[model samples]
Target: MSMNVQNCPRCGKLFVKGFAETCPACVKDIEAQYVACADYLRQNRKCDLQELHEETEVPMRQIIRFIREGRISIADSPNLTYPCEVCGNPIREHTMCDSCRQRLVRDVNQMMDEGKNNANAEKDAHHFRITDRLKDRH
Candidate 1:
């Protein structure tokens, strides 16, 4: 087992880092904030992300993280959205928007196709003929 120690980013306190980035105290605080935010959303289902943050006093980043992590479903809250990881466009559900995702897929497919084409070309070039080298003399 490996033991890890690092300063908590939230509190700047030295702690044994585990699955969470923050220390236990900060994790507890975040849990509290999540609970408060959830409770507020339950009472006011139509509230947007900004209103939720304003009402619960939870940081907008934290709220966005919650949404990204799938802790808070935004099915009823149509206005809730987080920035796409690749393009920074406001989106819900996945890490990237549809256009960015499609572009990534196309790029990956093109790279794979290029790799296959290169392999085929190398295979074709591997064959050598005695006549091919001495074609000018022949």
Candidate 2:
């Protein structure tokens, strides 16, 4: 059997036989990560989870959990903007936050209404044509 030895730097605990360098009870690494994330956010102002993950090598799920748990705040990014959900336009504050979406919805609704009206008019015209042809034959 091979013997493994390690030392915990924080608690001065001696680990042996397939144990971690840091003791399981010590939370130094977790505290350091929190401090790093906070510092990076304070310096950068605002960043997406993906950007922060790439820059700090933090896991995306952890970052999101941190944000949801009020450990980090997501603000409007001055340097970068996310795309609108509907039109793919860059928005600073919200997703699909643009006048274009409203306009497009209005235009689509109007076109649909016009199409319905035209169909009704066509049906009426067809009825008239059939009636006239029958009268002429009679």
Candidate 3:
């Protein structure tokens, strides 16, 4: 079967869709940007996100993505930071802050507990003691 071809979101060029989102040319450009950011950070280890962007001429979003992808290590570049996706707090790793991550986990756990309770209730609904049945009729 023929592979699907789509427009490169970055440069609007048509390309056979593969793993990368952008066309090959745009992908090369993105790699160059990453190299620029990595090289700049290697020298200026204490550079924050804004300064990195300014010095490397890389976009802030791309830098943030690199951090999220673990392409850049926060430990190596201690000053680099990006906003937490949920609360917008400055975070060097992961998509959200610790508090937000904990809260999300708590919520998910609660939902799972509730779903289990609901399933138990549903199973119990199909059965009734004779006394309960007599009461229902009354």
After superposition on all C-alphas, the RMSD of every candidate to the true structure, in Å, is: 2.7, 13.2, 2.4
Please write out the lDDT profile of model 2 over residues 1-138, one tens digit for every residue: 766766777578776624444666555565566677777878776676557778888665555545556666566345444456677665555446669768888999999999999999999877766677789997
Runs in model 1 with CA error above 4 Å? 1-4, 129-137
Best by lDDT: 1
**Which model is ahead, 1 or 3, in terms of lDDT?**
1
Candidate 1 pairs with clashing backbones: none
Which digits, one per residue and each the tens of the lDDT, describe model 3 over residues 8-104?
A: 9889999999999999999999899999988888889998998999998889998888888888787987777899999999987778899999999
lDDT of 1 at 50: 79
Q: Pick by TM-score: which candidate is best?
A: 3
Q: Which stretches of candidate 2 lie over 4 Å from their true place?
A: 1-43, 46-53, 57-73, 97-99, 129-138
Ranking by lDDT: 1, 3, 2
**Candidate 3 steric clashes:** 0
